[model samples]
Target: MSQPPITPVTTPPPDKGGDDMATLAKGGRTNTLGFILRLLGGLPFLFVGFRLYGVDEMGRFAAAFVVIEIFALICALGEKRGLAQRLTEGIETDEDTPANLVFDAMLVSLVVSGLACLLLITFPAIIFPNGTGSDFDMWMIAAIPAFALTEILLAAQAYRYDIATTVRARAVVEPWVKSIGITAFFFIPALAGGGIALAFLAAIYAALLTALYSFLRTYGLPKAWRPRPRYLSKMTSRALPLIGADVIERGTRLLDVFLLGQFTSAGTVGIYWFAKEVVSLPQKLKTSFEPILAPVITKNLKTGNMDAIASQVRQVGFWIIALQAGIALTLAIPGEAVMGLGGPEIVGGTGALAILLAAEVIASMAVVSESVLVYIARKRNLAISVGVITLQGTLSVGFILLVQHWGYPEGFQAAGAAAALFVALGVASLVKSLVLKTLLKAPVSNWRWPLVWAAAPAVIVGFIFTEFTPEWVEIIIGGPAIFAAYFWVIWKYGFDEADKVLFRKNVAPIDSDLNASN
Candidate 1:
């Protein structure tokens, strides 16, 4: 059966931008739902993990997993960034897009994955190393095909506005499945413990199988899947910068974790990972919006609709900052309670979580620029990324050296790492926003409300909560109230009539905004 032609939504008439902001805020809400799903998926794994393996053991499990993941990220370099562009023009022009892009994408994916596999094979000591255990090494080998296949197949899903499926498959089902299976394995005969790696390999393959089927069902099978030699060469040329961009982006995120494993104990990596996860949930929660935002911004750029482009750029940024600031305030204010959630040994991660969240607070702006620039000014965008990541690498390595020389506390090192990340991201955000202003002629100033209204209120509320509220009670109850009150103030007072309309898009725009007049 043939599907209806894909239609791009008409741009809302830009004004004060209340309704438009609301619509995209709603997109953040959807991302929040995806986050909840991810949390639900992760909790089962977390609970089972703690019960079965405990914190220190779980940390060791994470060591091999991080390397395998970094390898996977390296393999994904080009294909991920380039997909949004390939379909941008076609989606907007209402063209009969060819299915062959999938094949071309897959071919590129295969070559990269093969290269990664060869590297892993040739440098087993370098890749898996001697200390992380033979079980982990074996799991990495088993996981290579599954990780590569699942990630490679995900681009087509992004092209189709089918984010919910990707969300369900990865964030929802996969983790949940891993949790349940691993929890059961704790009772397995003779295998006394340490099945976490095996559980992950199983869950990943399950996700891979499901994702591949979903892609095939949505788009027809690979008739045009194979790229012609000439066509392949041309597409590869366009993708080169993106390969560099993705390497810098994903590589930097994983680089620290990999290095921490090498220099520090698996236990330190565990504490660091715990803290990073707390604040990162919100960042990861918002990630679902990236796929949708990418195509929309790319299409707007292709059509030269400056209004649509600016509106989206502003709206997504506004929404992301509002949400992340809320999460960051929660983590930073009562930093102890969040870290304590993992157990007493992990309490040291609190400072790390606070710093990482602060860094993510800055990074939210850069992520908005990441999607917008990829379509509107990919070359300029890529250059900014190169600069930022270069800055990050130098700062990270140098800071770690400085800290090692000083012999600081475990948590102090995390704080320094987070501090380094904050500085790097803040600089990067400024550069990218400036680039967007110069090239795309988009107003970076439109993102100011989030910086001022949202960030200010949350910071104030966090301060008040810390000072006035009692310790254990505040974390248990008052902590949540602080978060709630801050958002209420901003969403009610900070947001104007334009903001109100987004929630009430189902009703008349005026009706939605006026509801706020109360």
Candidate 2:
């Protein structure tokens, strides 16, 4: 039997201009909405877990959760961003429909997830050495297909510029289901112990259903779909570099947990997990941007529009850094109080929380830079990611061992690990930004002294509040006050027309004002 001829995919000429502004506006709005929903839906679960189940049980759940997430990342096969890039290419050239692209990704994801599941089942000890028990470990494996499928579905919608679908499934459906399920299950003595893991599995399945429904509603069902070896090879080959980068990128988060499991106690791991979870909230913004940014970057790359690409990277990088910096300041200002809310046992992780938040702030540049480089310099990008993770792993283990050698208390181990993470991430971000800057010959960071000026006053105010006021009072009064001060300074002196355009419905007036001011 003869194979179908492959349709040649061609790139469309770039728009004259204005595309970056439009994409940023739409992406920013949707991502912001998603971020808020995630915060609302997700935080409740952490509070419930810490308040009800305490640190140890949550630690057990955290252990299993890490394994499940690592496998999910593996099964995702980098399709989250890679699929967006491929879909953009197909749509631009009319080589394939959305259904075709989604179907291809789904098929690959299913196979990879299946393989991963089998491997986990075969060597459960290798992945979960502390052991989440056989039943919980099985549940972890069961969630992989759902996890992988949801990612692909959401990426498919993102390719269509329908980020709201991702927001709905991930932000609204998944987190709420988990939060509610975990709360309800805690009431039953039989199910109370593993409620977190159970709720997590339930949430993934719910998200999978939601994603499938949304994807089909938007793209319709696949037609005349048949698996082709050649097509699979092409897709996998294109996705391989991304798979390496994505796994290593995500593995950075899991590395501390894995190493801590080996070198520290479960209770300490739980405290660190809680702190990591809280600090990681801002990271949702970066993930939100990637889906939308991938297509824009891919389109620009196709047209050889390096200038537009750099401009987009710089703008988005600054946007992420600005927001993350504010969030970090807010969280880290009342760091102990923030952790206290989780539970008394976890409050000791305040130092870790502060350090991890700093890591997120520094990582903004690396995240946005890698997004652009992955398309243009796939090999180099992968190399950088590998280097970053290698450095992170080395620093993490070394710092952990040093703390032990110094006879520091176990409670301080997490902070030591977090400090190592900060150093490793700082090094990685600096190097990655330089590489992107050299490659593009344009600025990859839009940050200026004005941002620093804005941050200084906010930090000072936060410090004063922390020293004098109660935890609740500081959080209630200081958090918003700091953010307002930061934004006020930014608006008064730092924000340019492009930044203002993110807020305005129409860019023409802002553009005019910018010209007149100039």
Candidate 3:
């Protein structure tokens, strides 16, 4: 149960003071590999979920999935982000601190999760007024703590510089379990709807065991490990801010699922969710970096190195914009082909998918801004989150009105939600940029070149590909071209001579303590 944070090295261990360009290239390659593996591994589970559960049941499962995640975030209370920063910043590498802290965090989480599960199990009818799930659903919700712990532990591993464990558990093992379980649901009638829930419990535990083993092997058990009150206090103090931020951020996403559950049926929830999944596929590319980016950015900030942080922030933004844009473009342009594959049952979802994908494209900037805010000014990060949630709620209400005024159609309301979210994302991105710039006293204006250059090329790729190949190939090919264009534009125009010099200098160093932070 003792997990410690470690540093991540990009490629073949750097030689003495390895070159900065080599490290960045290696880091890019590392992220690229993780992205590929996640996409390949996640697809089978997603496909099987679609095929086995059809649309309505899949929607029910998806809604619960989001709800359980919210509960998991509550259990975490932000230790994942907080610990990643603390350990890597080389504040006080007692090593013993993090190892024991994991158990303490797990203990607190166990209590919170247990109490929540008890209420859910015993009072299912009492809590969920606009009931979509039964007592059976409540039981499924019990797995929340273990799953959340698995997530935190994975983050711990990444900070420990053991990223492959995280990738394997999330990308490979979790998906493999889910895909096989979903496939099994097709044959075992007993395993049909609720079975998806049980499968999640099994998968989480399996992943937990895998992570526990990996963490132990990579970083020995917490030194002189024993439950202690003072240790818990220290860890909790560090994580408190993180806890608040995590709650609001995740709560915002969960609010969407919960709101849908209230006014709509599982069937409608399914429709909205199907549209979300289709439109949000671009998110997968960024998801792999979720564990890695925070620590990397935090390391840069520890040295009071604003330039490196700004460079990374802009570079990541460019990549996210290019990739997310192509995905959103493909989904929006050929909405029918995408959801029609879900079969006629979910075909009413095409319009919703188009609107949601549009939202996702705009949301890319907010996605990258989040990392910057987290690393640079954590308290301000909380403020940014509040701003995001406030905007999201405001947009949600107006969008609902739009749907009502537009004359209700099957997917019209969801389309309204997507439109609202898109506007909210734009506001959040601008706010995030300003906050980051102010925090670092750096010119984030540098992020524009990659975006400006990628646009024309992206448009050209979309039009020509739509005319020539199928939507799938368009998805396959369009993303990389846009990304390539963005990278070239950035390397050429985004970086100044001084920027390249800094990039050139940061390779391997004999300074172990500094390298540990890196």
TM-score of 2: 0.93
lDDT by residue for model 3 over 375-471, one digit each (tens)?
A: 5567888887787888787777677666767778757766666666677767777878877777767655324545556456556765676688775
RMSD vs true structure, all candidates: 5.0, 4.8, 5.5
For candidate 2, the 10 contiguous residues with the lowest summed lDDT are 509-518
Ranking by TM-score: 2, 1, 3
Best by TM-score, which number?
2
TM-score of each: 0.85, 0.93, 0.81
| Most accurate candidate by lDDT | 2
Note the residue pairs that clash in candidate 3: 6-159, 6-160, 17-508, 17-509, 18-507, 18-508, 77-243
C-alpha lDDT values of all predictions: 0.65, 0.79, 0.62
lDDT of 1: 0.65
- Model 1 deviation from the true structure expressed as Cα RMSD, one decimal place: 5.0
lDDT of 3 at 475: 56
lDDT string for model 2 (272-314, tens) is 9989888766777677688888777777676777777777777
Residue 209 miss distance in model 1 (angstroms):
2.6
lDDT, residue 32, model 2: 74
Error of 3 at 497 (Å): 12
In Å, residue 251's CA in model 2 sits off its true spot by: 1.7
